[model samples]
Structures are given as structure tokens and as C-alpha cells.
Target: MGEDLTYLSFRVIDKKGRAHILEITLDTNYPKCPPSISADVPHIFNLDWSGNSKLKDAVVQFEHHVDKLQDFWSTLDDIDRSLWVVDPKDPHFAMSYRQINIGNDCYITLSVNASDPRSLPQCRFLGSDANVNLLRRKWKINCKRWVKDRSFSENLTSILDIELPQPPEVRKDDRQTECGVCYAQYLPIDDELGSKSGSATDYTCENNNCSRAFHSVCLRDWLRSITTTRRSFDVLFGNCPYCSNPVAVKIINKK
Candidate 1:
């Protein structure tokens, strides 16, 4: 098989706490040609010469595009500016967004061009054609400034100010019923939806001293992965995934 094409991927966050996946590709004819770039949803990249000349020149003229891309990724990581909402544990590229002015659960991808690290990236939407068109139009009218200054850190600081400049608003209910395994509030319906149909609802760690709750699916998976002496035939039991305490599973029927 032919060697895979050389490319790079980045996880960047916008001012609205939205995460984007930036994929840059350099073909065999690179330097003589500009590198290709793309991003995730509500795509509004403008790869035209006027907006993305720097990125074009960087890939076309310099043989160091590889190093430059790595440098850019390092910068985002060091500044703590990379987007994490998609996959909190490890950095794998996926698309999702929090509720914003536009709408929630609207998936879109931004196809962008990055010539150099400093020059603005030019992008346009690539997936869910109708949604992308609508989003691009809205972005062009209201978020021109935002699109023009697309540096990862620049947008991150702006979002941090808007989202956490003040203390987070704590919900009384959440405080009382946070999931111990994920330290997140249990959403029964969401748990049910994620689990095998009619299997079980979410679960709670049954150690009286450890009142942490967990999704039944999460607990089962954890039990399967961890090494433990507690077992019945092939079944396995282990300490609470959260606290290092003994735990028992309580399967709730889906409502």
C-alpha cells in the first residue's frame, strides 16, 4: 500500500466554548502548492488569497510546514487553550458543541486553509450542507471579527472571561446528586440511552461510606477492565471506580 499522506490535526476552542478540529494536509506536491486545511462545523473558512496568504505562503514556500504545525500544536497545549469538551480524557478529534446563540447539537465542520502559524486561517463549512450554509451566512454577518482573529489562545481567553470570569453558578440539585464515578450529575435518561436497551439504568456505588453514583454501563465496563480477586466464575468485582472503597452494583429498571 502507498504511504499515508502527511497531515496534522489540531483541537482548537472558540470564544463560545465551541471546539473545532483542524486538519492540515500536505500532498507530495507541497511547497510548489499550498497545503490543504479543514475544520469542524459551522464551517466558515475563507481560504482566498486576501485572508489566508500567510498560510498559503508558509506551506508553499517553506519546507518546514511540518515543524511549524507541531509548534502551533505545542503552543496551544502549553497555554491550556486546546478544546477538551469533545473527549475529556484524551485528545482524539471529535465534534460537539455547547448550547449557544445559534442552537444546540448542530453539527458542522469548517474547511480551512492555514499558510503559516500567525496568519488567519480561511475556512468554509464542509458537512451537513444546509446547516453549514445557514451558519456561514450568520457568521459572515455577525462574527466577522471573530473569524478574522482565529488564534487558539486569543479565542480561549475571550471565552474564559465570558464563561468563568465570575464564579460558576452551582445548582443545588447537582450538588446533592453528583455522580461519583465521573463527578458529574447522573442523567438517568442519558444513561439509559447509552446503555443496552432494557439492561439497566444508572447505578450507585453501594458502599455506605462512598455515596458516589455511576452509570451502570460505566461501572460494568470498569469492572471488566480492572484486575480484582472478587469474582463469581467469570464475573469480576472491584473497588469503586471513583473512591478506593468497596462497592456493589444496584441495577435500576429503565422508566
Candidate 2:
């Protein structure tokens, strides 16, 4: 293979919060290993983390396309045994493999991109160029993939969705007269049907007129019934449900 192979290295975090440095060797001896076929493989190296954590819970999975070698081992009893017999030079004999280790979890996947390059009836060794090139390029790409753990300071803006120009303060409006039944505020009702109760509450709706109030459980039940039945209320007590003005019923969520 000589200089036909290329090598790539990657730093991976396993499930145990341990870091692993992996090296992959690719054989770039084939014509199919050009940039066109390998572009998609490089972008798959991105890392996504759900929250503050250094370890990955699962092993990496690999996927690839098989161009040929459709029936190279149709008559073989054992697939692994047949793999050893297939000629490497076959253009239809494309190969892609990936291995990942996450703590104690490990996985290995393999596939073919092509089969026979010669297009001959009998199996023929097309040459070492294609096989070596394909392997080298694949290994080179995979070994370069890495995932890094980010700190809160580095990712705070993204998590909060806004930059802090000043320190956050406790707003006085956050507190409201919570209902005794449900211990929630008497706010606008999102649902219109089902259980409803006449109660006094201080919670206001987005619409200024609708000043209706209700126990939390009553409002919750009413909303649930309306949603389940897919119905709407026209007017509540002859006033706007939200602004309490002389208007029609509008759905609002009772806090």
C-alpha cells in the first residue's frame, strides 16, 4: 500500500466520562474515494449534547451506500466467511466500516459501496488502487471526528436564548391571588366547555376587559372538557371572556 494510505485522529468521550484518542487509517488507492463520494462522511462528525455532561451514553453508528457487489456471496453459507473470499479490486466491492466504544458499550458496522470494478463474469482483481484509496479515505475521515464537552459559561447564551445586559430581578407581577380549590390564579379560561364555577379572583387576562375568575380545579376541568369535545363558547356572562368588555367569548388560559 506504501503512501496510498492516509491517517486521521479523533478525540472521543466515552460513557464513563473518559476521553479516548482514536486513529483511523484509510487507503486512498481507489478512484471512487474522491471528494464527491466522501463529502457526506465528513459532516457526520458533529457532536450534540443534551445537557451538562462529559460522557456519551451510546456507541457511534456508521452508515454507507453500497454501489455494487449485489450478489458476490449469494451462494455462500457463511457471510463472514464469504467476505474473506471476495476480491478486493472489484469496483462493485466497496467497503465502509465504523467502530465506536462508549464505556462498556461497543459496536461495529460494515457495508459495501461497490463490488466489481472489472465488470467481468468471473471474480477478477481490479487492482490495489481502488481498495487502498477507499479504506484510507474512510479511516482518515472517521478518526478526525471529535466531540467536546461545553461549560455553562461557554453555552449560557444559547441556553437562555438571550444575552444578559444586566442582572435578572424578581418581578412583583409574578405573584397573583391563587385560587383556594386548585391553588392557582383565576385567569382567562382556555377551554369553554365542561366544568365551570363562579368565583372571585385577581388574575387578569391579556385582554384587559375579561375579568372572570374561577377556582383552579374548575377552570382546569372546564378547559379539558372543551378541548376534548372540540367546542367553543360564544359569550361568558354577556362580556368578553378576556377583557371583560361587552364582547364574545375568547379562549384564554386560566393561570
Candidate 3:
């Protein structure tokens, strides 16, 4: 009676939008020995093939009526489509919202390469120097909780709800502040009138995590190392070394 039957491989997304890779193989002695079903997501399906009559009955049903198995998979797919909303505007839609805004001017941008739901998404923070540092620290503290939950939407919600330390007060005399890049205290340049130039030490990173003031010369040198100049003009555009956010620096024209 056993004529021809082959194994089936399926890739499916669950209600949570997590993909599950599965393989169902009908044994040569199928009805006598239950079919083997293996899945990448162990929680979704488990088999007890230890001489269980129910297992044999299930396999026989699957063999006799393949539609039942297909129906089960289709149900999961439908559930996935209904629950997972992939919209860029919705912060709760993790797959769609690549950049998450958690108020306080803080942002967490997900890496495009992060496709696995089980793995923590590689992300970087953007904001004022203070907020960036605050978010980064928070992320480090709660990353394991996200992994345990394995729900992107839940993770986003929790991060946004977390309370962070108050941003430190801005220093009035930041002229002699140490440069975040060069690690040297800023020194004002002399003006034509032989007075300290106010703008000389004003080049501070806009990133909330790094309000470190830098000499224009030092900043230019640092920016140049990370980017190439444009063909027509000496302009460099790149992410901040600390935050990986867009930054543009132009070569100062010497008179």
C-alpha cells in the first residue's frame, strides 16, 4: 500500500512574526513508526515518538490527510499576518520601525542585518550627549530581559517606559573642557586683537552623550581620518564616532 511519499520542508512565520524552519519526514515504515517532525523553534512543536499509540494515530492521519497538516501551518501564517503590523509610523511595530524614538530626544536605530528575533538586535543610540549615554546604559542593563521576552514590541515598550537619570547640568565654563575625541582640554585661539576667540573652543559634539568641547583643529583632524573629501570640495560626511549618527564637517578655508 505504501507507494510514494516524500519529506516536506516548510519555512513559516509565527503569530509573533518569528520565522520557524521545519522538516517533516515520513519514515519508510511510516504508519508503524511515527513521522519525524523537526523544527528550528522548539517551542512550537514537540514530538514524543516513544511507542505512543496517539503518535501513530497522528502520523497516520497526517499521511492519510495531508490537508490537516497544511491547515495547521496556514493557521499559524494567518495568525502572524493579523498580529504583526509592519508599519514604520507605529513604534510598536518592531519589524517596520527601524528607528525607535523613546522620548527625551533619545533614539535607538536597529541594524538592518538583525533578522533573528531570538538574538538581541544590534542597535546604536542617538541624541544629545546626555540622553545617548543614558539610553546606552539602560540598554546594557535591560538587554537580557529583552532576550528573555523575545518580543520586540514588548521590548520597545519597556525601554520607553524606563526612567533614566536626569541629564547633567551644562557647564557655563566649557572652554577648557577636555575634547571627547583628542582627550585634551580645549585652548582658545588668539584673535587679531590678541584676545581669546569665543568660537575657538565652541566646537562641541551635538550628541547628548558627548558635550565635550574640542578645538576646531582637533575636530577637523578627527573627522578627516574617518571620511574622504568630496571630489569638488573638501567636505566630510560621516557618523559621530561615539554615536554613529550623521555628521558633516567642512574644511576651513585659510585666508
Candidate 4:
């Protein structure tokens, strides 16, 4: 409860070993009223409070809620580990939507149900019309075969009827920081150049489905070459090189 008597916190681990911090904000009339609940899960939980309900009761209810979503979380974990997830570049436990790359500029997006995860999810395919049509046909034929016993990846491979693509392992020597434009982790700096820390990739595409990175200098130059690019102050606005999504990069002046 820290030094304040109105606030309380409890740490609980799920059945699958995920740790969560449950925070409670108590009112001036704590026992008389129910405290608000906050956690790392995707959605909010209404407190089942009564006159006899105590702080301990809230913790139990939270645990039960989390336990009920074990299948949901496990499904997501398997998808994350097995597929090349391009959307939500950084995944958090709360995010239920996922977009996975399926090669040849094709991608599949899914909104998994937290309550009944093993069942078929809301699915959509993105890409050329021809590819989308083919994927839709495959889904129509294979979706009925889905089973809870199979993992998400296994089910997807069979349903899609195509081997899913995996993310490539970047060369260990340079880590995975290479700029998508220059294809190098660090810009070459000569004594005459006297480059700064900005040589490293500094800007990333904010598009949910495409998160390509680029050096500020490299991106600025690329954006300048585009006939349709726009500029306001020190920022250049243009489409991303790979995904053609709207992106903006600040042109910081270097001394």
C-alpha cells in the first residue's frame, strides 16, 4: 500500500508463469465502496463488490479472471513465436489483433477472441486481389477443420495450405539494427565527415503493418527524391519505401 493507506498493489503469477501487477485505487470510503481495479490484461474487469467484500476478495476475483484467459494467451504466444508478425511491431499482452506476413507481399490479420480463443477467429487477408481471392477460397475450405487440440501455427499451416514464412535471423555480428534503406547497421564515418551518433538508424515507420527503419540522413534524402513528398519546417512527409504508408522524418540540422 506504499505510505498511502488508500492505494494497494498485489503481484500475481498466472498458471502459465506470466507475472502481473494488480493495482487498486481506493476511495475515501474504501470499505464502504469498491476500489477500482487495474491490470495488464486486454480489457477492464468490473469489481464484484458487496458490503462484506474486502480487499482480499478483489484479488481472488482478478486471479480467476486471468486464469480464464489462459487458453487465449497461450494461442497468442504460439502465434508470436512461430509467425513473422509485422503488425504491432512491439506486442503487448493487451493487444488482441495480429498481422502476420505470409510472403509475396501477402499478409493475414486476425482478431483473437479472449473468451474462446481456440475457436476460429475473425480473419482477413491483405494483398493483391488475386492473392486475396485465392486465400479466401482456401480459408472457406479449411476453416471447418480447425481443432482446439492443434496449436495456432499448426492449424494455420494446414488451413492456409502454404508454409508460413518465418522472420529471418539477422547476422549476429551487426545485430538487427540495420536500416531498411541503406541495409547497414551504421553509416560509414570518415575523419573528414566527422559524423555524429545520428549515423545509427534513428527513424522508423509508424505504419502498424510496416515498421522499416532508416537513418535520418538516408530517409531525408529518399523523401526528397520523391516528386510527391511534402515538407513543413524541418520535417519531411512521404510514403514508406517498402509499404508506401505515410511516414514523416525530422530533418535535424547538424553543425
Candidate 5:
């Protein structure tokens, strides 16, 4: 059994088609003998991720099945090791677990390391082939299940099925000549321009309660100045001079 169980190897492929290899060496007299079976018998040979992207974009999952050694494995006697890249500059890294065991029939571990060139974490396992195989099969099944359910169309259809609220209608009135900003009557202009002339002030921000009135030239200058100052042309700037409340600015053509 010693020579037969000397080494074990496994490969991992991430969603992005990156491959990683893991190798472990087994001691026939593990945990029982001292010198031959070193305390660190189950060592993590290699734990790494592929792809040009860093490990942060990767995830690893493991499951262990130790049926005959359930009691020993379940007692948390097994060592847990981790592999990580310590240097901020390194691209790949690995870690190992000494011993670990959970109460479940099998131990399933899932890990996701955030992308940071400063730190990259990886996964590990210390168990028999049977245990590794069990875990690998389950991982494969879960991956297939996930791929089948991933879709945006299903979500969009659900949203489209829901009823939407109606929007309010807009009305226009021309009977009154009002300042575009304050919506106040254009200050009565001198009759020199005639009855159709209305107010010489061409436009105002139509907020009904504002008082600011401007000749088209004056308003244009104000707008240009505001634009140069990087101020928004929105109502949040304050109402026109004629109105106390917020007002909308509008441009009217005198022609």
C-alpha cells in the first residue's frame, strides 16, 4: 500500500477555462508512526489558478468522503491548510491545511478570493482517493446545474409581465403672455412696440411665483455666465426674480 498510494494528482478548470493542478503525497503509516509519518504527512503540493486574470476572479469547491474513518475525520482531527500568494506582485499562489473534519457525511468547502495582486488565496484537501472522487463528482453536478439556470431572458420576461403605471399628460396655453421663469405677466411694456408686441421681455423662467424679468439679451448673458461657472440649468438654482418658488426658464423668439 505504501508504494501504491505514494502520490495523487488532480486538475481544476475555472469558468474562464483556466487550469490548476494539485498534487499530494501519502504516507502509508500516516498519524501512527513518528519519523516515517511526519506530523505534516498530508502536504499541499500545488494549488494555483490559470488565466491572465488574477485568482480573485476564481472560485474553488471541495468535498471529502472518508467513510471508514468517519469518526476520526468527523472529530476535527484532520489538519486544514491554505495556499495563498503573500507578495502583492506575485500572480499565483497556493496554501495547505494540516487536518480538518466536519460532522456531515461529507465535507464540502467553497472558497472565493477577491482579486488583489497584494493577496491571492487558494484551496486544498488532505484525504483518500475515494473522498476526493466523491467531492469532484458533486462539484461537477453543481456546475452543470448552475449553467442551465443562468439567463437574463427569464428575468426580463418576468418584469415585462407586471403592470406599469400611466404617466401624466402635458397641456399648453397661449392666452396669457407670461415670463418663462416666473410665469408672471410680462411687465407691461411701453406701447411703442404696439398691441401685438406684448412685453419686450421675450422669455422668463415660468415659475409662477418668481419676479426676475430679463430682456432676451439679459437672460442669454445670465445663462452664458451660469454655464461658464459650471452651474446646472436646472430649477435647483432658484426661482426667477418674479416668483418666490422654483421656476423653469424658457426661451421665446420675438420674431
Candidate 6:
């Protein structure tokens, strides 16, 4: 059991020797009802339950599920550690999409398969039209070189023909530039496809020493809340949260 008695969590290691967490939300009725499951998996496993099912049964099922995803997790871990991933700012175990910066104002998003991890993944390129078109051509030309035996990074290098930027081994700032107010790049409006999306940051402080960026919507709300914010015709003025230096943002119109 976890912090609360009804919330139980267990660790399951995949064949590759990586640990994953599985949490079960028990129904109040216990054995008579099935428990809900949450795990660090690409897809949720269907629970096998009956009146005879015990609390331990859920953990056992999740452990078996982890075994099937060994290769999937292994490939993703390599990609994450190998590249300068720009989106999903903080990578989590459950997400399968990776948006990596590939230089020249462009990013390439890869959607890897959970089952056949070594296969060429579905890809989409983001950035200026010129860069996207050029990247697509490179992908088409070099995709046939992808080998299952090679690591994801190796295959990507062959396809792009460019040196990829690895995660900064040493950096002055390790913090993600999430909105200082809402503190997230994307927010889910609902569990289904109706979810709303958010941009990371549009406005940055002019002070070079404190170049903190913030989502305009989040900054507007925060500025409005503070009595010190100055209101102009169509702009709000305030000091940067980190440096106390002056900053301003235009009022976004809903119409």
C-alpha cells in the first residue's frame, strides 16, 4: 500500500532490468469489484478480475505486462539520452513521442512502436517549410539503412547525416523553462482527444542576466493578480518574477 491504504503501488522490472511502477486504485468493495490501474507504460493492460481476484493479482498482471515492453523501454531510453529532446520538456516513462531538435530552426518528432521497437517509427517534422521539406527528403533517402541491430541513435544519425546534440553533460542551469506561474508546457483538458494544448513560452525577460521566459497567458493572469502591475491601453506592465526588471505583454484578444 502507498500513502493511503487504498492506493497500492508495486515495482516491476522489465527483461532489460529497468524498473517500472504500477499503482492500483482499489475499489471500496475489494474482491467483489475490480481495481483501476495506472502504470509507467505506453498502454494500459487489461485487468483480469473476478470475485476471486486479490490485491496481489493486479501487481502480478502488471509485472507480466512489463516483460513484454522490455525492448520498447530500452529503445526510448537510448533516444532520450542520446538527443537534445525539446518537447515534452520533462520526459516521463509513459510517453512514446519525442520531439528532438535537429538544427536550422527545425525539430523532428518520432513516434516509436511499443511492440516492435527497432522498426522505423512514424515521423513528423516541425519548423520552417524549407527545413521540413529538406529533412523529409533526407529521411526518405536514408530510411532503408535502418537496422534492427543498431541503436536508435545510430539509425537516426545515418538518416539525418548530421551530428546530433546530446543532453548537456554540464550546464549552468538544469531547470526547464516552464511557465513560472502555471509551471507546465502542456495541460490536459480531459482524458480524451478534446484536451487543450499550451505553448511553452512566448515572452522572455529582456534582462540578459535573467532571461526567464513565461507563457503570455500565465504572465497576464499573474500580473493582473498583483497590485503593482501597470495597465496601459492594451498592455500590462510588470516586473520579471526572477529579476524584478520591467516587462510588458500585449493583451490577447479572444475575439
Question: Which prediction has the highest TM-score against the true structure?
Answer: 4
Q: Against the true structure, what is each candidate's TM-score?
A: 0.25, 0.14, 0.31, 0.63, 0.19, 0.61
CA RMSD of each candidate after superposition: 16.5, 28.4, 20.9, 14.6, 28.9, 15.7
Order of the predicted models by TM-score, top scorer first: 4, 6, 3, 1, 5, 2
Whole-model lDDT for model 3 versus the true structure?
A: 0.47
Following a full C-alpha superposition, what root-mean-square deviation does model 6 have from the true structure? 15.7
lDDT of 2 by residue, 125-150 (tens): 12256553444454445433311233
Q: Is candidate 1 or candidate 6 better by lDDT?
A: 6
Residue 125: error of model 4 in Å? Answer: 1.5
Q: What is the lDDT of residue 110 in candidate 5?
A: 25
After best superposition, candidate 6 residue 242: deviation in angstroms? 28
Model 4 ranges with Cα > 4 A deviation: 1-4, 170-255
The number of clashing residue pairs in model 4 is 0
The number of the candidate with the highest lDDT is 4
Per-residue C-alpha lDDT of model 4 across residues 16-97, encoded as one tens digit per residue: 4455689999988877889988887888678899889999999999899888877777777667656788788756667888
**Tens-digit lDDT track for model 1 on 1-255?**
125747766644332212345567765666455567765333224433333354444434222333234333333232222222221222222211211111233422222232333333333433466766665675565443443345543443342222222213334333325544445554445544444443332555443323456656566655655545256654445565433345554443445
- Candidate 3 lDDT over residue span 1-255, tens digit each: 223545765544332222334566778775567677754331323354645454444444333333223323332222222222222331211231255454566666754321233345678777899878877877787776664333455565565456433324446564337665656564455453133243445466554433446666666666655423222377655544433334556666543
For model 3, where is the 10-residue window of minimal lDDT? 85-94
Candidate 6 lDDT by residue in tens digits, 157-219: 899898876655433254347766677755434333222244456666654433566777777
Tens-digit lDDT track for model 5 on 1-255? 236766545554322212334444444553232112111112221223333422222222211211122222211111111111111221222322111232122332323222221111122333566766655554444333322132212221232232212112213342234544334555445454344244545544442212234554344444433322223543224223222223334433444
Q: Report the C-alpha displacement of residue 205, candidate 2, in angstroms.
A: 75
Model 1 scores worst on lDDT over the 10 consecutive residues at 93-102
Candidate 2 Cα errors over 4 Å, as ranges: 1-46, 58-79, 83-255
After superposition, the stretches of candidate 3 with alpha carbons farther than 4 Å from their true spots are: 1-154, 158-176, 186-199, 227-234
